[model samples]
Target: MLEVIGLSSAAQTLYAALVERSPATLAELGHDTATAARLEELGLVTRLPGDPPRYVAVSPELALDVLIQARTQQLTEARHRIAQLAARFHRSAPEQDSANLVEVVMGRQAVSRRFERLQREARRQVRVFDAPPYATGAAGNAVEFELLARGVEYRVLYDRRAVEAPGTLATIIGYLGAGEQARVGEVPVKLVLSDHPMAILPLRHDEHAVESALVVHDSTLLGALSELFEMYWERAAPLHVRRGRLAEATGAAEARRDLLPLLAAGLSDTAIAAHLGWSDRTVRRHVRAMMTRLDAQTRFQAGYQVVMRGWLAEP
Candidate 1:
């Protein structure tokens, strides 16, 4: 909460303590005049108007507003200054400087920070190739939805396993419902690109810690990455998240329903099994059952039945 309000660690510690143990004098709290004075100035701690005045914590609603406004104003001013400096810097930047085109960022925190910053600063679009192993959580998903709400087009390409993991299909369904375009297929690398100019990719494909990341600016490499994204997007099958009974259902029925589009798109059963996180035998079994249900003799007939039955349409 203090982080959200932009308070220093020391201030947060003192404020939390006061809120927990209020109506106590500074001395009783084992604090001297200096610390108390600072907290008072920040409107985190208040004093009762009586003999030997006691310090108390201000209401969180009022104090948080004060802190948030202060930080917001400071951010507004800083952004103004940064805009001016950026204009000057970009004006002097060398367009042909190959040495400065790519920057390496080290450590997990720094990589995560840069990734989130790129998403937050995206102007028109954000393209992401999501794969495992991933340490990020629902917060990242929430932020993406928020950005989508603000008219930033999100094109997300997820690895087959990433979508097949338990509980992920529903999340993808929600994303599709919110106007996000998604595809599921095998991808070589995890990537994040904002508006086609800036990109963040792992330093090594197999490393799990995100120990290093490469930030790519506008360059030939960026173009290659963009083309690579387009290539996968083209070959990838469209993802339609089913709702109602399909949404409430899981297991074989759910997986079979998801498999229809790939079948319609002419993907082999092996590829469909890989995407659906099932074995070849399981896929074949489901396909045979589906063919029987439709009284069809071939996969093509079953796929035609899918379209005719409206199984591929949005709910």
Candidate 2:
């Protein structure tokens, strides 16, 4: 938060200490006097004059108001400038298309067409949540290999189920080795994000079937989707499973390793399934299996067994 307001790390640390401790003197605070003075200049701290002078921490409510206003003003100006640049760079569009930010593309074929078009039109990055609900049965996606050849960055996150998805492993492996950064997690709702300030999220939030899709333009919703993808991306481990060779089992050990912490964190069956991109029934099945493995009669006992086995990695 301090960094958002352009405060240095040292300045933030000192300001926090001052706010919490209410240091009567800079010397007592035991921080660089220059940093305190900088904070004072930023209206984060106030120096009260006295025989024994003191530095007072300003109320964050007041200080942050000033910062927020400044940032808002700057963002407004930036929007104006971006609008101007966009006007110059972009061709005039159809009135109907321009009027609507969210365009609903119906049917699987239309969605696939949009995917290809978005990829080609994108200037820099392409983000995709690859999972079920295939529009085409060609064993690959709408994105072309020419994209990477031309230096377009691809950040694709696959559902754990999708990584083991039939006829898709070799394609995923090619993408992973060909400079496309990939990771796997349980992600529902298939969508594509292009560099052109828009995203394609499913009309249905809970399912992967692409009967329809919402093309989200530059809006708060688009920003939130980007953030959501980032949150999933951060939690998702990079795919390290060896290429080729379909194992007899889907490999529960690794999957269990990933599932334990979320279980420990007390996420519900449905919530865990949503994050891991598995079904609720599948999650319950796994829990039952885990309970049986540990010879536990209850979820509580299974949890205890997981902890006892150092599954939580407690030191």
Candidate 3:
């Protein structure tokens, strides 16, 4: 069976019309007039000067040549357009990657991109969830420094498990010393989550699992995740003075309100440490320091006194 292919039904009809009336105008040809008219416009037919637009198909030899030329021009234009797009896509790759995704990433370089996203998005407030004590590498640390220099507020929730990593402990302490919000607690999972452009890291410490990351930019998703972080922050113990205060609560204190609600939530020290990339020991140390500073006997008491005196809001 010799199967004819390529030309659409309308195109075949138009071509048949042209063959029947070799020198007929569009009005005279009348076969698939719409298709024929389009072909005529593409210069497959010759339109002579007359009262109305009159069309006649060029010789077969000439018409095929014109069609081939038209197709070649179309392909050439498409290639050029693709090249331009590729150049622009590479230029905007970093910023654009931050706006999408929710999954795990393997390899150091792939992880680097997530860090870049956090640095770029750490604007007003940066809340972290389930991270390592030394979750961020040197490049990541530098980015955090840049964020601090830019006056971007930050909050971290760390898992107690990360305390095992001494390097992570030092990193968290350094960030605290630099005046960023950091806390330690027990988390259900080990991951790093952000607000606007969020990223997550696994807590297992296994370098092979690529299923340990997540990134999201959708407003609803991020908001819900932020609420989760807040919920955890409430129950988690305070490792340092939050919102700039003396870590005490007496009467008519002048500090701004701290994240007391977060501390009130059920997040444990280990979970808290994981979320913010801090160690459990660091979390405990900060809490102990705060307790001593506030003259409170227990965690609840310390939190209560601070809230009562409103010292959490102090500068």
Q: Could you give candidate 1's per-residue lDDT for residues 1-315 as a string of tens digits?
A: 566665667667767778899888766767667777777887888878877788899898988788889999999999999999999887777764676789899887888888888889889999988886664654446778888899999998888767655566667767877878887666778998987479999988775547778999888899999999989876655677555222322576576667776665555777666656678897898888888988999887887787677776643
Q: Which candidate do you rate higher for lDDT, 1 or 2?
A: 1
lDDT of each: 0.76, 0.73, 0.58
lDDT of 3 at 156: 74
lDDT of 3 by residue, 1-315 (tens): 101223457665666676667666666655545776666665566766777566666676676666666777888999999999999999998676655545556555566667567667755666665444334444336666667778877777766555334355456656766667766565655544554566555524565433345555555666677677888777565555434332233332211222342343334566545544557785576567667877988877876776576554444
Off by over 4 Å in 3: 1-104, 133-140, 163-170, 193-195, 201-212, 241-315
Using all chains and alpha carbons, the TM-scores for the candidates as numbered come to 0.55, 0.47, 0.43
Residues 215-251, candidate 2: write the lDDT tens digits: 8888778888898888887655454323332122256
In model 1, how large is the Cα lDDT of residue 83? Answer: 100
Which 10-residue span in candidate 1 carries the lowest summed lDDT? Answer: 241-250
Model 2 segments beyond 4 Å from truth?
Answer: 1-99, 205-208, 240-315
Q: Among these predicted structures, which one has the highest TM-score?
A: 1
Candidate 3: global Cα-lDDT? 0.58
1 or 2: which has the higher TM-score? 1
lDDT of 2: 0.73
